[model samples]
Target chain A: MTRCRFWRLDRHPEGNTDFARFLSLQEEDCAPLADGEVRIATEWLSMDAGTRMWMSPRTDGYQPPLPLGSKMVGLVLGRVIESADAGYPVGALVRGFGQWADVATVVPALTGLEVVDETVADPRQHFGALGMNAWTAYVGVKEVASVKPGEWLVVSAAAGATGSLACQVGRNLGAKVVGIAGGADKCRYLTEEVGVDMAIDYRNEDVDARLAEVPGGVNAFFDNVGGPILDAVLGNMAHYGRVAVCGMVAGYDTDAPMPGPAKFDQVLMRRLRIEGFFIPDFLHRGAEFMPQLREWLDAGKLAVRFDETAGLENVLTAYERMLTGKNIGKVVVKL
Target chain B: MTRCRFWRLDRHPEGNTDFARFLSLQEEDCAPLADGEVRIATEWLSMDAGTRMWMSPRTDGYQPPLPLGSKMVGLVLGRVIESADAGYPVGALVRGFGQWADVATVVPALTGLEVVDETVADPRQHFGALGMNAWTAYVGVKEVASVKPGEWLVVSAAAGATGSLACQVGRNLGAKVVGIAGGADKCRYLTEEVGVDMAIDYRNEDVDARLAEVPGGVNAFFDNVGGPILDAVLGNMAHYGRVAVCGMVAGYDTDAPMPGPAKFDQVLMRRLRIEGFFIPDFLHRGAEFMPQLREWLDAGKLAVRFDETAGLENVLTAYERMLTGKNIGKVVVKL
Candidate 1:
């Protein structure tokens, strides 16, 4: 039996910052893989805001609250070392929802475990450019927001994984992009490295005032944070604007829901459309979305900056960074 | 010269109830029709919640605030007594946006003036089954909400003009309809007269608790009132549900915007779609909508209860009644 170390959720978290108090790192012997299950030798784990909601006791999330005393669940990218499933064979690179452990044992069908291409220059791209975040950015910006050429597209949490890719996706689709981020560094990265038309430092700048200056108002919004920033964007939306609600990281940490945006009346006032979508709901359409995502990635139009942290012991640190907007891009922990 | 009695805006009202303090009944001699203008001897004036929004000094509504001291504008159903436009000849019955006056002067193109079919059994049917409210109900139910057969549909303010029509439209399309309104009488009117499968008295019962009893959750929502009622409906919406925001009458009364529904997060949690639309944008498709509405009316499937109030001098009393939900169904003033 292989010895494995995993973070167990000891209690439901109150907010994003208190994860250490609710979770504990423990070592255990790996149990034999059940039939139709695959065991992955975890090499890296993607820290996402969604997992933070599952960690709370909130009953209103897309997925039910994670039961206490269970292994913390998150996106895992690694190789399948042992398998009882025919589809996920041994020696295959895989990515899906798996435990935060050195060896993650998961039911292939239940975990959405599937083999990933090994031909990509960087295996980490599985969690970056060609991953769930990219799929979300692609679907949200292209299909949901219905962005057209020369239209103004605004992205919130623009320095993060999905938002960064969404910015590039909007740009590649010929939309003029305005990225909203927390600090000068992320703002600079958005305008310089990410090639956005403009970057608003939300922490220092008045988001509402800046967005008000947008010519013809913002026609499309790809939103991750759904609190004050959402209100600011809603107030500045053009007539018949579309808002693709990708995430509400602002309310993920707490059990209580964040209050609805103050300017939500703008939805009716401007005759707008607001739609909420997640990547998992569109999993079946990954094949349809992949060709375009890959082409942009290969042509250097789509890029993701990795805010990497080493060791599973520091997963909490990396997660807090992502949740609190401390990191500039995708936050990942190397096992 | 013909004498004209019209309501003029003296000041913006603070709430739906205070119209008496802001508007005054005044008389003036009607001027000769200008080029492309048509004059209508107003027979009936449609009382609408939309005009209530225009009465506030709020600048955030779809249309600009109605300028103080201008004639109060409303829908007029009458005969064209004078015309400079060839399209609308004298003696033709017409309906369009015109002044709340005995003799309404209008530019045919600007006010959406169009001659009506005179053969219908009741001219009031033009303000009932074939009116703007019916068109709004049809578009909101069939196109915006996208209610499928056998699905549960919830309509707020179900005793109001548009809401009642929406409930019938949903039923006509084979959807299971649930109507929500404020009083027991309104609830009775919904279930008995409107033929809704279920009726919840929002003032007497817990809307959220009652909606929770829906077998498969509410699949579509035609919301006229947007406050706690909206929040209740949001909490009970099925996965991928659609909300057609026809009006936000709860906020229409005040200059300050109503806060968004407390369960706004449900949009993301349930993967819902919320869209806002008004009748004016769809005026061009009135011809396309008329045949089906006429069929329903002719077949006895469509009906509107007129809460008739006599005299243009009492227009405020009638308008206030409609705005405050004191009257059921279509409220109109006889000139």
Candidate 2:
């Protein structure tokens, strides 16, 4: 038996990801790998808004309530310590779905773990650039939206993990990219560092006014933060524009019921399409998405950034920081 | 010269479509029809929520307001008094893009005047069943939402022009149509007369409770009145549900600034697709839709209803009744 530490959602956080609500460290016995099972010691965990809705009561509480005293569900990088599964050899570095914990057990029934090499670049990018965030940005813009070169693209939270990747990827594909973030610093990072054509700090800038600068109008909008930002984007979308419903971190802790100014009118007026997707929804496309993303990263066509916190105890802090928009890139917890 | 009465957005109404505010009505000289021209003696006009949007001032105040004294745009039926265009001859009755006046002249380039026989069914249905309302309802459900037979289909404002048509069309297409209307009277008209599978008088019934009764959950939701009804539907939508954004009557009057609770999360959680569409946007399909609709009506497979108001001067009264939900089915002004 080996000691394994984990973090789980405590009660339901009211507004921000409540780090103080995290449970104290607990011990768990590592069971021997069962037939067709693999045992892994988690090295890194990715924190993002994609999993936020699963925590809400409205999601039919499908995902097990982040068990009161267990690690939260997230993506993690681990090394296979033991394997009863023939395909997964012991000592191979792999990534799979797990909690903010030090170790995870897996089987083929679940999405199989993929081995990644850290020496090539930062191993953490495997949890980011080559992982779900980048894949979401890639598949959403390229596949779901079927974005064409020369199309005008707008991305919300452009300084964040998925948005930054999407903007850079859109630019690489010959599409012009506009980024919207929270502050001047993040906006500057997006245009100057992430290589976006333009960046809008929504906090100070008017989205509609800035949109006019795009000439005709945005052909596609990759949204990460919903609410007013989504509304603004809808108002300026060109006829036949496509909107990929990325995330709605803006109203995560909101208790007030959302009312109707339901913007369906705009959707009709502009003949818009709003498609909601989670990376898992496109799991079947992994065979294609992974190889393509790997090439983009290896060729240095994509930029990767990550904010990592050491130890499982710091998981909740990382989550809080993410919700507060304190991190500029992907927020990950290192176990 | 012919006397014609037309309603303009005198000053966009605050809460209701005020007839007095419908700024213009006058006797105008008619020009002799040239090649490819058809002069129509207008007989019927339909009222809808879309007209309100065109009537109001743009928030940015950029585009000219739907020119203050121009004829309102809507579906209209008329008898051709003369035609220089070989396609339509004198005494031919048809329906097309006309106005609230007693007479209208249209160029062949823009006319979609479908010849109809009133003895077979009321010609008024040409503007209801085979007109913009029915076609809009059919396309919104069958095409954009891609509703499947045996799936749950819910429609808001289930008693109005488009709503009633959608309900019947959903039922005819093998869907269990659940309509959401404002009062018991409309609800009765929907289920008892219109053949909707079920009815929800949102004014008295609990939508969530009623939704729970429809065991299959909602596979497709054809939304007409957005806001709380839409929010409630979001929480109960089945996986891969499609929400057809037809109209949002809920937000037409409130003076509040337009920030609403974004159910953008709903789209992702259920893998939903919420698409908005304007009928004209799909005008290219009119060639196919109109013929198919006429065939359906001629075969007695579909039915249409209307609340008819006689006289062009009553246009304002008709518009008010439609806005207040006082009229069932299509509200048409007759000359």
Candidate 3:
């Protein structure tokens, strides 16, 4: 029997910091695979802000809260070590919602487990440009927000995984992209590295004043951090603007409900369309999006800067980094 | 020179109750029509809540603020007394955005002036089943909200003009209709006269609790009153539901911007769409919508219960009654 290390949720989180107090790392003998289950030797773990809501006890989240004492679940990338499912052959490169363990087990269908293309140079791109984050960006910018060529597309949390990809997606589609990030460093990365048209350092600059300079107002907004940032964008949108609510990272830290954008009435005032979307709900359409993403990757039109943390022991650190807006790009734990 | 009795906006109104303090009923000598202008012998005025925003100094509204001292603008139904434009000939029954006056002058093209069908037994139907309100309900329920057959549709301000028409439109589309109103009498009217499947009296009843009883949650919402009522519906919407934001009467009474719905985060949780639409924006499509509305009216399938107020002097009383939710249906001032 193989020994596996995993994090277990002991209690709901209170704040962004001190996540370890509620989760404990434990070692146990790996259980025999049940029918239709596959085991992965976890090589990498993607740290996502949306998972914070799963740790919360709030029933109003996208999905039900993870019960206490359960192994912490997340998107994992690795080779399939063992399989009870014929589709997931052993040694196949796979990615899905699996445990934060060295040996992660998952129900093939439930965890959205799929074998990824191995031809790509860096397999980590499966969790980057070719990942769910990229899919979210593609769907939000192109389909939901309906960004037209030559339109002004504004992205909140633009230094993060999804927003960065959203900016690129908007640019590829011929939209003028404006990115809003928390720090000067992140803003610099967005403008210099990601090559966005404009980057607003939200923490250091007047976001409202900066956005006001965009002629004809923002045509589409891909919002990852909702709260006051959402309010700022709402007030600056053009008539008939579309807002794609991708994630509300601003409210994920607490159990208390997030106060909505104060300027929400602007929806009517400006004839705006605000639509909220969660990526997991759209997972089945991955095959439909991958070819274009794979092309973007091959052409160097799409790229992601990885903020990698070594070892499973630092999973909480990476999570906190992503949650606290300290990471400039996709934060992931390498086991 | 012909004389006219018009309501002038002396000052921006501070509240819904004291309209008399800001607006005065004044007598004016009718000015000569400009080259493209048309004048109407105003017979009746449509008291729409959306007009309240024009009386406010808020520059951020759908249109620029109406200048103080301007004649209060509203939908006028009457015969064209004179016209420099060929489309609106003398003695032609018409409806357009004109003044709240006995003799309303308008620039034909700007006000969306159209010669109405005078053959209908009740000419008031131009301000009723065949009116802009009907067009609003048709477009909002069918196009914006996209209420489908067998889906559950909820309409707020169910006893008012657009709301009542929305309820009927939803019903006509084979939807299970739910109406939310302020009073028991209105609730009764919604269920009995409008024939809605469910009626929620928001003023006295537990709205959230009642909505929880809806099987599979509300699929579409036509919100005329936005405030706490919007929050209640947002919390109870089904996954992938649509909300057509038609009006914000709750905020229209005051100059202050309305606080957003507290449960707006539910938009993400449920993957919902909230879109705002102004009726005037869709005015050009009236000809495309009128045939179906006229058919519905002639078939007796669509009817508007009129809350008629007599005389121009009682316009303030009628306006206050409609604004305060004292009227059961379409409130019109018979000039």
Candidate 4:
């Protein structure tokens, strides 16, 4: 029997550390797959706040619960060693929904799993800067927010994978970008490295008052952190502002009820637009983003930062660390 | 000097009241229009809930306080018996911003004052069904919400002027329209008269559970009343649903906080779009809406309900009654 480690919901996550406990899977002993199935060896894993809500029972019956003993759900970069499906071949490096384990089998319906090109400078970039995180940031800022040149684009969790990419995308579109991060170091990296016009360490200064510095106030806000920050930003937004609700990183771990009676009152009185978007919602536009992002990268207008963790053994720890805002950019686990 | 009576917010309305307070404006003794002004005798007056928010401090700081001992701000129909402006002719029956008073002098800039064609059915219909309330309802549902054919559209304050017009507009667009109202009488009018697909008396029925009857779930929700009912309707929304934030009649008198939390979690997960709009935001789109609405009106596909009150003396009472959902359809005071 082949032994593989897996992360499962620990019946209950007591606190931050509960992100630590995951079960081991004996893959060779599990039930056999039906006709169209493929087995993979997971190389890299992506961690996000959305995964936490999926594990929780409080999701209003919208999300299915993570079965007590089943492997946790996540996106991963892996190689297909075996296949019952003709489309995906052995030795292909593909990315898709996979168990947190090193090896897993998936059906054809779970096929967002696409083979990666070996010619790229770094294969991991396909799962990070040029991947789902960056693509989501790009589409939401450009399409949903409809941000125009010279407008102020404010983003929270601004040094993280999606947030940093969003700030860069905003700048490339000629918008004045303001980033909100947790500490001084992250804020510096966002403004100096990512080329954001301004940076706010939300842990220190007041977000709403500092927004007055933008003069005309924010035109579009790409939010990765939601809670008091969302409430504060909504109050200072300009009339007819657009807010792209991207992630709720701030509210995930709190024992307290979600920190909002979010001032949606401002939403009406100011005639603002707040839209929520998931990356997969715009997957059809994936090809469109690739060429444009490639152009920016080729011109050195795009800069990517990776918080690289070596080996799959530290994957769970890296995920926990990512959630606590320890990583500066894309959190990537290297094989 | 002729005495003109009006209602003052003597105090910010703590709760819905009869709105008892004396406000008077004296008739001008010398009223030849000075260069670019017009002197007019006011005939009809309109009192709306929009005046409520402007009472405290301007929420957007765009409008100023209605000064003590001054006339209340509203729209009125009047005859320009005297005109100093070359553009505005004498004896012109114009509709524009005026006081709750019987007469006033106004400049061209403060006036959208249009010359009325008296041959039309119910000149007040121009101010009611075809006026700001109806126009707002039209633009919000058509432009902002973008209600398409066969989509489920639900509206709050379903028997009010805007609500009634929105139901017709939704129907004209081939949408299945649902309305939520306070009483059975309003619900009956919404279905039997305004011709909605379904009507929910929020006071009597379980709003969330009954919405399951709509099958596909509401695709668009035109919210006039902002309170618990909005919270209830939110649960029954489909993915990618649109919410047009028009008014907050339910919380017009609310001084303290209500129980509804910010629904960002559901919003993000469902990929919903929530937008607040002022009618003027789409003034540029009137060239698009007017011809189509006129076509619908001429084809008899659209209908309107008007609650016409007579005399300026009843304006304050009518306005207060509107806040409490007392009137059905467009609440207007005819000359």
Candidate 5:
């Protein structure tokens, strides 16, 4: 038996997560791996805004709410130390949806696990730029929004994981990208580093006024932060614009009912197309995504920055920071 | 010179349109027809909710706000009285965006004028079931929403022109249709006359509670009336649902800022797609729309109910009633 430490959901959260009250850290013994099973030592845990949604009492979301008294759900990068499964050889790195734990036993048939090649690219890149974030931005900009060259595309939360990638991808697709971020630093990162044509410091500047100054108006909006910003963007959208509804991190922490876009009339008046998507639905098109993303990464056309915290003990702080928009890029915790 | 009576935009309205203040009845001398022009005597004028949007001060809508002192723009069915053009012979019926006037001179090259064949279908039917209303519903449901058989489709304002047609069309596509309308009469009309599976009297019953009673949930939403009802429907939508935003008659009369759906977060959580569409953008597909609509009309699979008032002088009352949801089916003025 191997000793394992993991976080368990003690209760559903209200408003902002009270991590200590809703989650419990427990140490347990893992049974020896059966045939076709591998025991992995968790190395890094990816904390995303989506994780917060699972803790909410709302059951109508795409993914079901987390069950009370179960291991808190998350995606993790791990190394296979003990493997009875020939497919997952010992010393190989793997990635999958495993609980936030120091170690986990993965059954090949029962769960989805992908072997990672560290030599090709860093494993962390796979978790951020080269993985879910890139795939989401790719499918959203190329497939859903169908962004065209010279078209003005606006992206909210431009400094966040998916938004950052979407900004770069929109530029690669020949779109004139306008980014919206909270602070001066994130806004600067968006324009100077991420290569967006312009960045609005939403905390300082008026989003609607700034957007209205754009010459031809916003042809597409890639929304990550929903709320007043989303409403403001809706008001500035050009005729027949498209909106790719990615994430609403702004509303994830609120216990009170979040209000819809007040300017939703723009959706009707401008003939906008707003589509909400889940990345898992487009994983089948990974062949179409990974290659282009890899090429861009190699060409230096794309770059990823991580706001990483060391140790699983600090996961709560990292998560709280992410929910409060304190992190600049992808928020991750090393176990 | 022929004396012609027309309605002109006197000024932009503040709230519920003051017909006498914002609009003026003017007696004008009709100019003689040119070599390629035809003069038509207006018979039936289509008074739609879209006409009210043109009177608002908002300049960023799909159609521009009506310029002050111009004729109130509307679709009209008329008979050609004088013709210098061979294509538009005398006594032929025509339909186009002409003034709210008794007579209009149409130049075939400059303006779109469709010559209606009364023998094939009544000219008034051309304005209702076989005209813009049917086309709007067809494009929104078939092309935009892409509703499938057995899918539960909820249509707002099911007693209105486009909504009524959308209900019938959803049934034709094998969908279980639920309609939201005001008053018990309109609700009864939706279920019995329009062949909807269920009808929710929004005036009497709670839309969200009734929609929750639906077994499979709402697969698609054909939204014509946007307001609290639209927000309620958002909460009841099924996963991967589609919403076709056709109109917002509820907000058409308001000068005050309108609040959007309070439950719009459902748009992201449920992976829903909301598309706003204009009928004119799909007008090129008339070859695809007209034949099918004509067939439905011929087979009695579709029927049109017109809330018509006599005389152009009463156009103001009819327009007000249409905007306020006082009329059932298509509201028109028989000039």
Candidate 6:
């Protein structure tokens, strides 16, 4: 038997997640792997804002709420230590929904475990740029927004995981990408590192004013942070602009309902199309997208930024940091 | 030469149109028709909520603002009194954008005038069911929403010109239709006359609660009235639902900015797609839709309700009545 540590959801959060009170670290004994099962030693745990939404009492969403006393749900990249499954051999690196645990027993068929390619230069890239974030941005910009060349593409929360990748994707697709981020450093990183044409620091400048100055106005908006920022963007959208709503991170933690976009009339007046998407819906398109992403990665046309914390013990701290927009890119905990 | 009476925009309205103040009855002298020009004596003038939007001072939108001193823009069905154009012979009944006028000279090529079929029982039906209203409904329901059979469709302002047609179109496409109208009379007309599966009188019942009672929730929403009603429908939308935003009449008269949909998060949570479209954008599709519309009209599958006032001199009164929701169905001024 092996002792494994995992975080359990002790209670539903009222507003913002109170990690200490709502979640508890629990130790559980794991028996030897059964037939068609593999034991994984978790290495990297991805922290997502969506995790907070799952902690709410609401059951009427795209995903079901996490029941009380259950292991907190999350995605993990791990290496198989023991395997009774032929498909997942011992020492094979794999990625799947293993929750927040140091060790997890998974049946590849049940968990839909994916074996990571060993030849990839950086495995962490798979957790972000080559994984969910990049895939979401690709689907949004290419599939939903259908971003055209010379079109002004605006990305909200541009320093975050999905938004950062979306900026690069927009530029790669020949769009004039503008990034909206918090603080001076992140804005600088957006323009310099992410290679966006312009970066607006929401804390310092008026988003609507800056967007108004753009020559033709925003033709496509890839929104991650919803609320007032969405309204501001709506006011500046060009005629027939498209908005791909990837996430509404700004309102995720609020107990009170977030206000809707004030400039929503622009939706009718400008003939805009606002569509929301889930990453899981387009996972099948990965085969068509991954090769192009890999080529871009190999050719040095695309770059990824990782904001990693050293240990699983500090996952809560990292999560809080991510929620507050303290981290510049993908927030992950190394176990 | 013939004398023509028309409404000219004296100034832009501040809030709800003060028609008496901003619009003035002006008499103009019509010269003899030049080559390819036809002089039309107006019959029924269409009063649309969209006319108010053009009255605003804002120049940025899908259509340009109505300039001061120009005739107030509107659609009119008229008979050709005299014609220099061979295509539009004298005594032909035509429909085109002739502003609010009793007589006007138009070059058919420039104005895109269409000669109305003489076999039509009621010429008013052309304005309501077989013309722009029906076309708008068809494009929104079939082309934009792509409303599938057995799907639940919720239409706002469901007793209005476009909304009534949209409900019938949804039912015609084998969809389970629900209508949200303002009053009990309109609600009755929706269920009894329009043949909607359900009708909710927003003046009395809670739209969101009633929608929640529906088995699977709204799969497609055809919105003409936008504001609180749009928010309510958004809250009860099924996963991957589509909203075709044809108009936002609720906010069309407001002085201050109208509040957006409060339940907008459902757009992301339910993965909703909200797209705005104009009739002109899909005018090319009229060839595909008009034949089917004509068949439905002839087959008694579709019925039109005209809320008309006598004489073009009372056009402002009818326009005001349409704007205030006092008139149900298609509001037209009969000359």
Query: What does chain B score (TM) in every candidate?
Result: 0.98, 0.89, 0.99, 0.89, 0.94, 0.95
- Identify the runs in model 6 with alpha carbons over 4 angstroms from their true place: A14-18, A31-38, A82-89, A106-112, B11-18, B31-38, B82-90, B107-112
Regions of model 2 farther than 4 Å from truth:
A8-10, A32-36, A52-64, A115-122, A254-265, A309-317, A333-335, B2-9, B21-25, B31-37, B59-64, B84-89, B108-121, B253-264
Q: On residues B1-335, what C-alpha lDDT tens digit does candidate 4 reach at each position?
A: 43445444455545666466434324444434477777677877766676666554444532565655555677777888778776779888787776676665678666566666566566776666556776788877987888999999999988887888888888988899999988899999988988898999988999878887888778998988777777777777888898898887766666543433345566676777888886545434444556666676667666777677887767767877788888887677765
Full ranking by DockQ:
3, 1, 5, 6, 4, 2
How far residue B326's Cα lies from its native spot in candidate 2, in Å, is 2.6
TM-score of 2: 0.90
lDDT of 4 by residue, A107-182 (tens): 7465467776667787777766668887888898999889999999999998988898899999999999999998
Off by over 4 Å in 1: none
Q: Which predicted model would earn the best DockQ?
A: 3
What is candidate 3's lDDT per residue for A16-67, written digit by digit as tens? 9999999999999998989999999999999988888899999988999999
Query: Looking at the true structure's interface, with contacts defined as alpha carbon pairs within 8 Å between chains A and B, what fraction does model 6 recover?
Result: 0.72
| Chain A TM-score values for every predicted structure, listed in order | 0.98, 0.92, 0.99, 0.92, 0.94, 0.95
Instruction: Tell me which of candidates 4 and 5 scores higher on lDDT.
Output: 5
Residues B82-129, candidate 6: write the lDDT tens digits.
Answer: 998888888999987777988867877665588878899899987877
DockQ of all candidate complexes: 0.81, 0.39, 0.86, 0.51, 0.73, 0.69
Model 1, A149-229: lDDT tens digits are: 999999999999999999999999999999999999999999989999989999999999999989999999999989999
Model 3 Cα shift for residue B152 (angstroms): 1.1
True contacts kept of each: 0.72, 0.55, 0.79, 0.48, 0.86, 0.72
Instruction: Estimate the TM-score of every prediction.
Output: 0.98, 0.90, 0.99, 0.93, 0.94, 0.94
Off by over 4 Å in 5: A14-18, A31-38, A82-91, A106-111, B14-18, B32-38, B82-90, B106-111
- Candidate 2 lDDT, tens digit per residue, B106-214? 7756645566655645877777777778888889889887888889899998898888888878887889889999898998888788888889988998988888888
Cα misplacement distance, residue A268 of candidate 5 (Å)? 1.0
Candidate 6 residues A75-138, lDDT tens each? Answer: 7899999999888888999987677889977777655577877788888887776777788899
Better of 1 and 5 by DockQ: 1
Off by over 4 Å in 3: none
Write down the worst ten-residue block by lDDT for model 3 chain B: B252-261
